[model samples]
Target: MSASDHPAAIRLRQLSIRLGLGSAAFEAVQNVSLDIEPGQFVCLLGPSGCGKSTLLGALAGHLTPASGQALLDGERVAGPHPERGLVFQHHTLFPWKTVAQNVAFGLKMKGVDAATRQRQAEEFIDLVGLTGFARHYPGQLSGGMQQRVEIARVLINHPRVLLMDEPFGALDALTRLKMQELLLEIRERIRTTVLFVTHDIDEALLLADRVLIMSPRPGRIIEDLPVDLPRPRFAAAGSARFASLKQHCLALLRYDEPATSLPRLTPLGAPPAHQLQFAI
Candidate 1:
């Protein structure tokens, strides 16, 4: 592949993951491979049970792949590191800690001194528009505010890659839109490589440089599409191109019926629902 084909940020090669043991095992992801360019925003999108989040965890090293590899800058990923920050569906801030404290936790873990951590945390908190809430604990913040802190916390580390798993899934519609805009702003300034997971097609198109669509169970990549839409991604739900991409993704996500043979899902064992009652 040329440099344009694989710009060398994150790459997954024939990756597969299994959840359970023996006959009960389900292949959450199988023979999935993808490439993300440096400083790119890529979304892994699929239905609820399609294993998108599982792939995110594997890429972040929170879950081990049953086979294949997750690579960062062409190097194999073994486990979670300071270089990779993950934002989950839930706001993962420490309830007892203040916003600044939560944001500084990663630097502290890396043995960064108090002064440097405070400086770094302040910069990112401001970047995320949460400077005023630095002293407030998670309980004092609203859902959107809490997610902002989570974003600041991760970004403060200056991680080379960000793995986000439905970070806006819990927010109200307006808040979600605002968060998406903020994310675009952050990407513009920092050029961080992002791997985001979401079930919302519109959100994916709004934020991704490319959108990877995965199939049903034994989730494998079904489509790899670049979103060539013009950016400073405006919030026009009525835009013609946006509507077209959204419809295209919706069509891909809608399955006709349970696939009969259910491909072997190379590298992982079979799914848990194989012998039992199954629903797709």
Candidate 2:
């Protein structure tokens, strides 16, 4: 089926996840439910150990929900499927493979012919702005370039849902900003459903169509907010509307903590420094 006809919308019905067994078991995510529309960019923002990643894991079919269910369209997500692609903070590329080879690995395993795999791989490689480096091994590329290869690897498969767990988290500030811009550009071209997990409020405000804030441990969704901002948010970050939204999110995330505990938002239109602290 074409992507338009495919079951792309993701739904979670009272989903909860517990790790371990017996007395040792502890609930990682508790009674959370949310809907992600097809071709939407949704961000999950929370403090560390808040189970945002656990919820994402359940959605990606890497972990089974202890109760309730995660559904794509109407079908239960029982296990990993190619239709649901995942990208994590670290680059999971094959060290021995060239960039082109790494991007084509999935197609190769799916029994696609060599010619088709090479063609598609190159297309995605160029899509992510790595055309000239197709033959370079992962070791030879910068951290940002390696992450681009990882994204290209997943996108070439044409997944219905893309689950990103801080895919740009490990990069330096400048690289992270560029990657975010690249992601927005890519979404315009591919229009895939995306569920991105991040702890940075500004990052969430900048990229998401909607942001869901979760409370600390035994994580539960405390807020479901629409961004309501214009596209090209990188440029809009200094606007009053953007600042208001940022403050709103900050209030929710830091309600219990002291005001001095978290750093203030960067001034309007200022270049964010590499060492700016994120309110986790």
Candidate 3:
């Protein structure tokens, strides 16, 4: 039941979203308008506090738009739907639950039979390369492995649109690379509209079909750049074209920004709990 059959298209029309309450309230993203083709993998790349996650939250229905409209497949995205799966930087898996149980939670919530839920959960466990670890709890797995379980849980729902907010941002460098490769492999099998938020330019270049550059504070799409590299971009990433694109991205990110710090914004509008470091 993969969304490969018919992925969802996302459209935004003059969307504006504000964060905080009362005197602290301020626009996070402003007048954002864009159309993402069905099955397209688009990365929202920008500095911290640029509203990449805010816009993604709007699409995921975790946050409502202050103005304009957010639509998925021609319908309004007024609230959360199973078809729109959201993954965060950290795994929100229940520590008490086993991998299989966590992955099966969604199905169980939908009133699926236990036998059917177990079977489907097994399939996704194998899909994420965790075949023999079904009984393992979150505490037993590594950070990367826990994230894999989170991803399996999300994918088991067969989402038409996948919203990721720096899903691999917390992993070590080597682990992050492996996770990226794994993500590419998974996306090859399950076609869906992916809107990923990242501050790392290299990650954006390697994973996205197109990259959306956002501005600081009142974020807006300043640029929509396409990654024309071939798939399995390991080799392509070293080519001159990749370097050129990286340079352009650096310029865009570094343009006229002050040395002063800006707090990273989250989907929930709470103060940032962690700092984000940019990679050249």
Q: Considering summed lDDT, which 10 consecutive residues are worst modelled in model 1?
A: 261-270
| Candidate 3 global TM-score | 0.91
- Tell me how candidate 1 scores on lDDT: 0.82
Clashes in candidate 2: how many?
0
Query: What would the per-residue lDDT of candidate 1 be over residues 167-191, giving only the tens digit for each residue?
Result: 9999999999999999888876777
lDDT of 2 by residue, 194-229 (tens): 999999988999999999988888898888888887
> Residue 226 CA error for candidate 1 (Å)?
1.2
Q: What residue pairs clash in candidate 2, if any at all?
A: none
Candidate 3 stretches with Cα past 4 Å from truth are 257-280
Greater lDDT among 2 and 3 belongs to: 3
How much lDDT does candidate 3 score?
0.89
Candidate numbers, best lDDT first, in rank order:
3, 2, 1
Cα error, residue 35 of model 3, in Å, equals 0.5
**Global CA lDDT computed for model 2:** 0.87
TM-score, one value per model:
0.87, 0.89, 0.91
